[model samples]
Target: MREHEAQARTPRRDARSAATGQARRGDVSGLHYTPDKARRSANLAAFVQKTRAVDSRGAADLQKLFAEGDFIERIGALVAPHGLRIDNVADAYTMWWITAWHAARGENDDPSPATLTAVRAQAAHAITATGEIARASDAQKQELAEALWVQSALIDVAMEQAKRDPSRLRAVGDAVRQGAKGMGLNLDTIDLTSKGFVPVGVGQNDAPATTPKPGSAAPYGALALAAGGIGVGGFLMLRQRRG
Candidate 1:
């Protein structure tokens, strides 16, 4: 996994409520956000809602689907053309569900052959119909982008938490789903291809200003340090023997 540097900017102000001008503070059940963040929050909320809807049996099936050796590579190839990358195993799993949701909602919009092939590979796990990708309204596109961004944010937070304690990954997943349920979005009506249903207080605050690249130096630095230490130690031992 690549090391993602944390953002250096000051946190933006909390989002204002449309009905009330006051800054929406974090509620006991959830976090507050500005309009943009709200959209992301809503996207994540909806994602969690759908995830929660999956039955245990279906989840096991999904686990099996993701376990395929080529699954991650296939997803990478399909999304890379669109300037996206799966950051981790959790991101890959979240993306699988998001991809299925988009396909079901007809949001693919003239998917390339590679995209189609990737989609078909997981067709059996789709909870909804494997609909064709068709052109969507601008609002729909914006919604989809925001949703993807939110998914990335959730994955980032979950990955960070997992670093400290692996069990927190499951807890984070469950919490996100629960948070979305608390936000009151009618998950059944969340159609990414349609417009005009903005869920309040759900914002995209968690996303970093810039997406980090997987080629960052942190991973390589550790290897380099270890190799250099080994070389230095061997040289010191040889010098002492010669003395």
Candidate 2:
């Protein structure tokens, strides 16, 4: 009976090994076998590599889009309903792009409420600039809408990434600045002032220095000297009158 049990276990072990071998050979029958830990790790690494490749492609595309002269025009019709002008849209887009880039790098990319409000206001102005949002053909409108959606999605993803890692904000800013320069735009001149968002290292030169009010208290030593001088002058006058 023990010999028979050993023989039976040998067949089962052989079958299991065969299945694993088939799986290793990329057989469809091996689908039922769960991959080993090493296999799983390889799959994960491949997935990450693919994802990074896609992201790199997207970043290149975005850079190309930024450098195009007709970028604003292409997006203008889509944003018209929100009353945004070309400049307004450009400003908002730049803001979102910079923030999104920072966020993508795992930086604190949260925009201030003022910045949000300003962007919204510009979008509104864009709507007014177009005079009518429905003027574009349906297909054109759809394309514009899709483009805007992509932009918004990028921003959302960046924001989420930034939430996970906040150390990449400076890098993000540098990236945006470089991108803007490549497009013949100055990052510093983007005009966030209308939204109450001043760039770093600005406004210091124009700010007035504090001045003391007239007739304020003098130093203690000066006060003491003045009092002593008055007292001596009075004593001299009194002594002269007596003489």
lDDT of each: 0.31, 0.37
Cα lDDT tens digits for candidate 1, 179-216:
33343323333322222112234332121111111111
In model 1, which residue pairs have backbone atoms overlapping below 3 Å? 15-34, 37-203, 37-204, 38-202, 38-203, 41-203
How much does candidate 1 score in TM-score? 0.26
> Model 1, residue 101: displacement in angstroms?
13
Backbone clashes in each candidate structure, one number apiece? 6, 13
Q: RMSD to the native, candidate 2?
A: 32.4
Where model 2 places Cα greater than 4 Å from the true spot, the runs are 1-115, 130-135, 159-186, 191-243
